[model samples]
Target chain A: MQWETVIGLEVHVQLATQSKIFSGSANKFGAEPNTQANVVDLALPGTLPVVNTEALTLAIKFGLAIGAEICTHSVFDRKNYFYPDSPKGYQTTQMDYPIVGPGELEIELANGTKKSIRIHHAHLEEDAGKSLHEAFHGSTGIDLNRAGTPLIEIVSEPDMSGPAEAVAFAKKLHSLVTNIGITDGEMSQGSMRFDVNISIRPVGETTLGTRTETKNLNSFKFMEDAINQEVERQIEVLESGGTIAQETRLYNGDTGLSRPMRSKEEANDYRYFPCPDLLPIIIDKSTIEAIRATLPELPEAKKARFIADYQLSEYDADALSSETKLASYFETCAKTSDDAKLSANWVMGDVSGLLNKNDMHISACPISAENLGALITRIKDGSISGKIAKQVFESMWAGEGDADTIIDAKGLKQNSDEAALESMIDEVIANNPKQVENYRAAEADKRKKMTGFFVGQIMKASKGQANPGLVNKLLAKKLNG
Target chain B: MHSKQLFFTSIGLVKPFELVLEQTMSVTKDDIAKVAKLARIQIDAEQVPEITHGINEILSLVDKMQQADTTHVKPLANPHDATQRLRADEVTAINERDKLMANAPESDSGLFLVPKVIE
Candidate 1:
């Protein structure tokens, strides 16, 4: 029997606030361990917790962006667990009444079809500290710098069927959050992480299978890898006449393996109740509207704008507006060049290729958007052909001067001079007599194809500096005669 | 799976003595044992019943308060329907690793050292 996989994702995005969620502790990343912890974050006996208004505001922004229902009154619950990472013995989180409820995110699959993944809910919660086992010399060390940091836990419905759809959903989510300027969505620094709940059943089965959660996958590639591995593992167990145990498994990303951290027989009891320290966060309609007014242009809206305003194809617009930095970079280039289609193509093609080759993000690209725009401007004004502009772009990527300077210094401008282009075509017709005869004898449609041969010769004789359109006109005049 | 309630003081302007209905869940000897383990406290088996009896008598009064019949009363996280004061999202604290480590029982390399924990 064929198998089908069921997947749902729970993502934790660290809100880009300057302070901890419930305390005034500084929330900078990579601080010395325990340094960012305050009395409240450290769980001192006398310290009282207070709600972070900025966290609430950002959570509301997320709810508004996704069109989720913003719960007017949400209470904080203490999720009790015994661990060194949580010094307070419990994590303060929203349980029954999450801040956001029942939203959907639209994603585009690699096959160019749209999918709407329903989000079950999203809640605001405080993060626990890190447990360091490697450098502790037989003891575990705790880093409380991450403790009490505000996070929005987005829970998605079990709507995805495979790893590809799951990754598409995650990438769309990352784009949405980063575009809206809520979180940086940096997977490396643990800014955004995911816990995948996956199960496999026989194909066409209506009921759900037992799911085993794989915890704390920080990158998209590893999340996909872990899900595929888990699905295969479950399928093998069932094929061998075994049952899939519901457990919490720790995924080893390097080995593509997972081991059960908590088996079905040894599940921890996380006693949860309303936290008495915090008050119910009462959100009025005015507050939600206030946050809605402050919303930035989200990714889907920006993509639509690219298609509408710039007349870009859906594929090009999606590629150009995938990231905020790239989108703004493309916008700057397009606006500067006044050639939106050309700018979109160059940014998506050459710029992205160079960025990928050099191990850089669009933000750290060496070539400025303004300079790239100027280069495209040269191409538009017939100062340089598209071929010469690529050379200029390569040199500019190597930190050479601006487009005009590169064109002037290297003599790489297009030779649109009519006489010069004609002379080159004359040289090609005189040298390749057999090809000229072949072109003159062929039918109109067949001769159209032979024009490429003469055009190649003319361009080669000019050393690729001659204008192709002018060369084509001059070649046809000389060859057809 | 054990479910037990831990007492936490309400900071929402509710008087401590007036929160009588919060005590409906009476603590049993089993609850005391489970809570002691969760809190990482040392407790003798003989003392569980004594502590359970002492805690239940107070809880009985709390349970009796539930009969006051406040059907129209809304459930509130804070007794007072007061709005919370908002704080600007700013970095008010700085790294004080040494001062913080002074409060820890043990420390090494800017990290709090605890007994080896897995999972």
Candidate 2:
């Protein structure tokens, strides 16, 4: 019997606020451990946790973006837990009442299947400090610079079946958070983290099987691999007549397996109670509406607009909209050039390929959007063929010159004039009389392909600058006659 | 259930609820020690009982969160919308080698310090 893996992910996003959640300490990363920390972070005597309004506003902004209900009154709770990283004996978080209610996220799978992942709720909490084991003499050192940093833990329903959906969901979430200007969503720096809850059951099993919660999945590859391994582990356990234990586990990338860490705990174990130090957050209707007004065009909406406005294929639009930087660059190029489709093709194809090859980003591209637009415009205006424009683009990419200057300096203008193009077309026909005869005797379908070959030769002879439409018309006329 | 103390007395159970060993979720004192070790914290051995009790209590709280009819509940993934509040996408900050080394536990002129390597 086949088994289906059900997955849910709880992602922790560290807010990009300048200060800590409760203290005035800088929320910056990579600082001296205790230097940026304050008395509150050290959990000194008589220091109380003062909730940051900016952090709370950031949480509400997230709620509005996902169409979740913003709770006017929400309370912070004390999660009693002991750990070296949590300087405060108890972590201050939202338990009984979170600031935001249920939300939803819709992600498109690789196969173009759209799946809606339901968000249970998002709550604001303080992050724990980092433990640097590489430091200290035979002991791990604790850095409280990240301690008390505000984070919003977004929980999702167990709606995903496989790794692809899980990854798509993660990328969608990462893009959404970064796009909203909330967090940098840098997985490498641990700014964003994912903990996926995975469970596998027989194809038609009604009751949910034992689930394994994988922690510290910092990258998309890890997220996908972790889920696949855990699912396989559970399936093996059930197949061998051994019961799978519901527990927290760690993923070992090298071994491609998950090892149990501990039993998963329920929330009540934290002794959660409303934090008395901080007051309940009350957001009025106007606040939510004002936040909604500031939201920019989301990726889904932008992708659709690219398809409609630029007359681009869905694949091209999706690729262009994957990164905010790339989408902006495309828009910038489009603003100056009327050939939006051509611009999309270049940006998504050649520009993207070059950037990937060099391990660069669109923002790091040496070619400015105006220069790229000039290259496309040159092609459209018969100054260069599509092929020569690519060469000009390569020159522009190397910071040599703009399209117009490069074309002039290299004498690469298209031979699109009636006389000039006809001369090249006739030369090709004269050199290959057999091909010309075949072009005459071939069926309509074969004739169409020959037209492409003849056009290619004319453009090649003219150094990729023969007017393609005129070359096609002249070649057909010459071959037919 | 309203007269909870009286009802529990009638059922031969008392206030604070007499937790049966067989049914009390069974987190042993040794398990608590192991959990603290996994969490990488140093706690006095004598404090294990109290810590175990506290962790059990907290775990019960997490249990309550899971029990709440969250069948249709969606988890909030991030607190912000899907837009990057991008800065000028330009490098503005520079790493100060001197100041960065100043705070190091041990350092040399402008480099971080390490223990002697060669004989």
Candidate 3:
């Protein structure tokens, strides 16, 4: 029986701020434990949470970006819970009224399918401290530095059906948050965290099945795998005449299965009530629109614009617009050389491959945009063959300046001279008499592929400097008749 | 499953004692105990009776929330709705070791002191 896996995600993005949400303490990441803890962070007697104006503004920026309904008046709720990670016994969060409500984000599946994940609401809350185990001696240590940090948790509607869509949604959220300069969206640093709600239903059943929420799966791949594994587990249980119990499960990365942790509970489990300390936040239309004005062009709009403006392939445009830095770099290069397709092709194909292989970001790329544009222009002008241009790019990777200097230093100029390439083409033809006879006798379609082999030989004999177009013309003449 | 009349119904049709004895519709004690364990809070068996009662009360509240046609209602995650105000990207302060460590239970030589960290 086919089972549809229903999935939704709750992502918490640590807002990029300099101070703790309610306190004046510096919101630095790597400070000593408890050192960054101010009186308010410690929740000392008489310490009150003064709402950070900057944090509120950041939340508004997100609301506008996603086209969410910005609530003019929202109240903070105290969610009472006990955990070592939570410095305060209760977390100050939004329960009754959230700041941003009902928006949609578009995610592209792994199979190149695109879907929109409907957002329920996004609200600002304080992050709990980190419970560091095995970081010190045998005992666990608490880092209050992260405590009271401002975070915006974006919750999604249960609109996704599989892990691929869930991953796409997460990635889309990551790009949106980072592009808006709201959060770093670093999954590795626990900067962005995900809680996945998963359930399995029969192929055509409309009524929702019981859902188990798996919390804190940081990596995108693991989150996707965990959802798939949990869906399979739920299906097996249902098929065996058992019903899914609404529960919280733990995803063991080692075993690649979710073990039942405990049954899930209603929100009142924490006895959620309005927080008394902070007052209701009232935002005006002008305030929200003002923040909207500052928002960078979002990923979807940017992707569409890149396609039309740069005349880039959808794949190339999508890949380039995955991050702001790469999109900016590609745009800068295109502006310099007016070669959008070339810029998109190079950034997506070569530059991205290099960065991923080295585990680096585009901002840290060794090659600058201007230099890359110069390299593309060289390839365009036939100053170098595409193969030799790759060699110059590798030299630039080693800290060499632009294309011309690298090409000059390495003698990578294309052998565009017709006589020189024609002689090499003759040598290729002389060496392969039998293949040439077959190529001359074969059908038109068959001869087309064989021409490539002759071109390869001529390009190789010329030490990768043979201009490909000239080499192809000469090889075709030498092969036919 | 038999739908037992709940004790705390809007209409007083059933007795509270009969409601506790009836195990047809509501969640069982075993499930509540399991949920408490999953929540990582230690609840004594003697407290199970009270915890189960509390859970039932909360579940009923959730049922009420679910009754509200929330298909159109957006689930809220944050309370403050506006762009987060940002500061100019710059670092302005450094840690003052003595001042920071002043609140430590024990300290010496600008570092917080704890009993025998390692042998």
Candidate 4:
């Protein structure tokens, strides 16, 4: 029996704010436990929560970037659960109305086909604290420093059919959020987390099957692996006449296995009610307009601009404009080197390969854009051959001086001077008298192939600094004569 | 009855107490037990009847208020019609871990320790 998989992603993005969502505590990562927790974050008696203006503004900024409808009048509600991570008995979240409404994101598949995924909504909420299970005998340690961090939970419709589309959507969303400057987009630090909902059914069935949610997958590879594992597990169970249970499961990235979280079974009933301590938030039209004005140049717009301004190919423009740092680097390099095509090739080829090898980001690249541009300029102006420029690039990466300094110090300049190249070609012809006589006596086709022998001799005489193009031209003129 | 009427009146519910007393509202002992378990509270079996009766009385009062014509009324999130106050995003709180951990029953290494709550 053929089965089709359905998937949806709920992504939690931590907003880049200076303080907690509803408190004045510091919202930094890797602080000592409980140090950033204050009276309101701790949920002390007689302490009330006041919303942070920057959190709301950033949330609106995201909504505008996605072209979603902004709910001017939104309210907070209480989600009651019992856990050590939550000091209060309930979590404050948006239930009925959220800041962002239904929107859509377009993703390009590997086949170059575009598909639109619908975004259900995004809401503002406070994050829960951390629960440390290790270093304690028969007890759990709770750290409340992360209890009240501001987050916007982006919920998507179950529009994906397989792991590839899901990964594509995830990458597109990551680029979009980071480009807009709302979140730090750091998956390792838990700034952006994904929860994948996967279910499978007969290929032609319209109604959905029972879905299990794999929660808190931080990396794109893990998300793809978890989805594939869960889908296989579901198909196996159904084929054996077993049913899939609707529960939340934890994906162990190290072992590549998932199991149902036992603690979440009985804790599912989140009795929700409007939070009375905080009133409704009514944003004005002018405020939305003001936030819309602050939206930066998003990924699609930047890609288009890169193509138009740099005269780059569609593929090269897409690759360079996906990240803000790489886009700026390419622009500077292209402008300085005066060659967009060559700049694109070097940036996407050698530079990217080096970054991947060193496990570093483009921002940490040792070869500065200006130095790389200077190297490219040397290649274009015949100061150094393209092959030799690579050597210069390596030296520059090793903290050696720029292209001009390295070229001068190593005496690696191309011998493009016509007079010098002709003397070297004349010497090659005189030394290889038999080859020149054979070339002059042979037909045009055989004579054309015989020119390589003379060029090789001339290049060997010049110690590889001799320009191959000039050697070929001069050798043909001397040997034919 | 007067106190019940005033309780509804104070929250802006204009229902009379006698109307609630006439209605037949009930809370079973099993319902009380279930609620107590959900709240993680310990309750004695002998106190079940009294607690059930007290809960039934409160439910009747709520039922009377629910009968009011509120078709055009919006759900009141807060008592006052004021909007939520916004705070500037500034880190004004400092590390008070020592003073705050003093309130915990058991703490070690700047963490609040509780009975093992493993998942």
Candidate 5:
């Protein structure tokens, strides 16, 4: 029986606030275990929490960016659960009234088709701390540095069908959040986490099937892999006379396997109640409009502008404008080089390749955008060949000086001088007499292909500095003459 | 609901009344045991009936209070009727780990050590 996979994603984005959501404690990563945890974060007796204004502002900013209805009044609720990471024994979160109401995110699939994923809602919550099991003897070590960190959990409707759609939605959401400067978007540092709910039913079945949630997947690749793995497992179970269990599962990316979290399955009841310690957050209309004004150029808007202003292809504009930093980088490079298409190609191809090879983000790229633009500018002019510009780019990436300096020092300039290229073509034509004779006798198409031999010889003689375009024009003129 | 109406009236908002109270709400010994377990509170089996009876009485009082119609009243998240005050995003908390860890039963390497929790 054919089965269709139904999936939804719950994305938890840690807001980039200077302090914790409800306390003045530092919300920094990689801090000493409990150094950043304050009395409020530790949930000490006689202590109370004060909401951070910046956290609320950031959440509102995100809501505005997504065209979601900003909840004028939202309340915090306590999700009762017993865990070492939660010092309060109850996670302070938004239950019924979330901050952001229904919104839609349009994602571009690989087939160049657009699909809108409906976001159910986004809520503000405080993050739990870390539980380190290793490096302790028969005990778990609890670090409260991350406790009280502000997070906006964006819940999506079960609109996605398969892994690709899920991944595309995740990537699009990541780009959107990062571009709006809400989260650092460092998936490695757990700034953003994903909980994917997957279920399967017969292809034509209208009713929903029991779903299993794979929790805490940090990376897109893992989300995709986990979705595929869970979907396959559910199908196998249903096909072999077994029912799919509705439980939370953990996906170990290392082993490429998922297993049910037995502890979580037994304790599924998170009795939530409105928190009495804090009052409802009431946002005014002026404040919402102010935050909306501060909303940066979102990815979609930037992509449209890139297409309209820079005249970039839809694909190129989408790739370049996906991230704010990359879009600005491409813009600077294109403007400096006076060629948008070339800059787009170089940024998307060679520069991205280098960044991926070194496992570095575009922000940490060693080559400055202006420097790359200078190199491309040299190629645009007759100063250097595209091939030599690549060599120069490597040198620039290696901390060498600018394009002009590298070309002058290495003597890698393109010999585009008409007299020089003509003489080199003449030398190649004289040396390859038989080939030249055959070229003169051959048909137009075959003779056009024979120019490569002379061009190669002349480039070799000129030490690869001879201009290929000029050499081709002069070679055809001299050979055919 | 009576207490809620009183609280709202005290805050200068009068709630309209249409009395409809459900007296079926009651607690059982098993429910008491479950609540006790959930709260991680120890309760002897002999005391379950007494606790359940006590809870049922309180619930009866609550049911009587529920007679007050509060359909027009907004759900009161806090009794004070005050919105949350926002603080500036500044880190004023110092590294009080050494001072705070003094209260812990066991701590090592700046981490609070608890009984092994394997998941």
Candidate 6:
């Protein structure tokens, strides 16, 4: 029997607030272990937490972006648990009444199909600190710098079909959050983290199967891997006459396996109660409008605009506008050159290909988009062939110089002069008389194939600087005669 | 289930029924054990019954305060407005890890080290 994988994601985005959610401690990454924790973060006696205005406004901005209902009155509850990372006995979060209510996100799958994933709710919460396991001589070390950091947990319904759809949903979320300037969307630093709940049931079954939550999957590749592994594990267990258990599993990327945490401490019963210290925040409709007005063009909006404004294909627009930086880079290059299609091809083809090979991002690329745009202009103007343009682009990428400077230094300017190209064509014909006779006697389609020989010879004679269009034109004239 | 708890504002204003419900509430041995476990505290097994009795006695004494009807009293969340003391969200923290970690029972590599946690 076929099996279907059901998946839902709980994403935590660490808000871009300057201070802790309820404390004045610096909300930053890579700080000394406990340095950023202040009295309020440390849960000192008589130290009460005051909500940060930036955190509140950013949460509102996210809610507005999703077109979700912003709860006018929301309370902070205490999620009681015991762990070294959480110095306080309880974590302050929203339970039952979140700041953001029902919403939806439209995710585009790999096959170019769009599916809407339902969002249950999202709430503002404080992040716990880190627990380091390797350095303490069998003891675990805790870094409280991340303690009390502000975060917004977005919960989604189990509407995903498989791992690919789950990843698409996550990528869409990452783009939306970063596009709105709410968070930096850095996966490596745990800025945007995902917890995927995965389960598999027999096909055509309406009831759901027990799921195991794979926690703290930061990278996209890892998230995809974890879901696939968990789905297989559940299916295997079901097929072998075993029942799946509902538990939390950790995906070990090194081993390519998922395993349940130690069972002794598997107790997850959190006694939630309203925190009495702080009052609930009441957000007005005007406040939501004000935040909505501040939102930048989201990913979908920018993609549509790129398609309409530049007359680009849907796929090209989608790929270019997925990330804000890449979209801006494409825009800069597109506007600088006359051939927008050529600019798009160069940016998406050679530029992205080189960056991926070297494991660098577009923002860190050595070649500027302006320089690439100018190089495309040369190719359009017949100053350089596409093949020779690559050579110039490679040199420019290596920090040699701009497009014109590199072309001049290497003498890569294509010889578009008809006289120069005709002489080279004549030289190629004189050297290959046998092949020329063979081509004249052959069928009409046969001589078409034979043109490559003369074109190759002429290109080599010109040291690859001969204009390709000119060479092709000269070759057809001499070969047919 | 009274969701008056959901509203941090507009609370205590509805009626005196919620206050009565809270006043009549009492804890059993199981409730005490569960609450103590959540708070990460340990108590002797022999003291469970004594603690239970003590809590009931204390709760009964506090129940006397609920007898007075103060229907004229207006409900308020705080003395001031709903918004509390305002401070601009800025980073003013200095690195005090060394001083802060001084209180830990054990530390290593600028980290607070404890018994190996299972999860």
lDDT of each: 0.84, 0.74, 0.76, 0.86, 0.87, 0.83
- Model 5's C-alpha root-mean-square deviation from the true structure amounts to 4.2
Runs of candidate 5 exceeding 4 Å displacement: A264-266, B1-23
TM-score of chain A of 6: 0.92
Q: Residue A435 deviation, candidate 4, in Å?
A: 5.4
Top lDDT model: 5
Comparison by lDDT, 3 against 5, better one: 5
Tens digits of lDDT, candidate 6, A1-481: 7999999999999999899999889998887778898777877789888888888788888888888889877777777678888888789998766889889999988786789999999999999999887766779988889999999999999999998999999999999998888888888899999999988888899999888899988889999998877887888899999999899988876777778976555557675666667776677788778888998898999989988998999989989999888888888888888667888898899999999999888899898878888998898898999899999999999999999999999999999899889988888889889999998999997777888888888889999998888788878988885
Kindly provide the TM-score of model 3 when superposed on the true structure, using C-alpha atoms.
Answer: 0.76
For candidate 5, list the clashing residue pairs, or say none: none
Error of 1 at A134 (Å): 0.9
**Each candidate's iRMS in angstroms?**
4.5, 13.2, 9.7, 4.1, 5.6, 4.7
Model 5, A47-164: lDDT tens digits are 9989999999999888888789999999888787788889887899998889999999998887878999999999999999999999899999999999999999999999999999
Model 5, C-alpha of A341: deviation from truth (Å):
0.3
TM-score: model 1 vs. ground truth: 0.89
Best by DockQ: 5
Question: How well is each residue in A109-174 modelled by candidate 1, as lDDT tens digits?
Answer: 778788899999999999999999888778999999899999999999999999999999999899
Higher-DockQ candidate of 3 and 5:
5
Stretches of candidate 1 off by over 4 Å are: A1-4, A108-115, A201-207, A262-267, A425-454, B1-28, B55-71
lDDT of 1 by residue, B6-105 (tens): 3322111123234555446566678777666655667678877776776666567657766777767666555766655667787776667788689888
Lowest lDDT 10-residue stretch of candidate 2 chain A: A262-271
Chain A TM-score by candidate, in order: 0.91, 0.86, 0.88, 0.93, 0.96, 0.92
Residue A153 of model 5, lDDT score: 97
lDDT of residue A127 for candidate 6: 99
- lDDT digits (tens) for residues A1-481 of candidate 3: 8889899889998988888788777876777667777667767678787777778888888988888899887777777665655656689888668888889887777677778789999988999986545445544555567888899899999999888888888888888888888887777888899999998888899998999989888888889888888888888899999998887877777777777664322333664655656766778889887888898898888989988887888888777887888889999888876788888778888998999999999999999998898889888888987778888999899888688998888788887899888778778888998988888889999889878788777767888888888777777777774
Which of 2 and 5 is the better model by lDDT?
5
Report the lDDT tens digits of candidate 4 across residue range A1-481. 9999999999999999999999999999999899999988889999999999999999998888888999999988777677889998788998778889999899998898899999999999999999899999989999999999999999999999999999999999989888888888889999999999999999999999999999999999999999999999999999999999998999998998999988534577565667777898999999999999989899999999988988898999999988888888988898899999999999999999999999888999998888889899999998888888888888888988988999999999999899988888877777777887788999998887877787778778887788888788777777776
lDDT of 2 by residue, A23-100 (tens): 777778777546666667767678876666678777888888788998876767667665656777678888757888
| TM-score for chain B of each model, two decimals | 0.67, 0.55, 0.44, 0.72, 0.77, 0.59
Candidate 4 Cα lDDT to native: 0.86
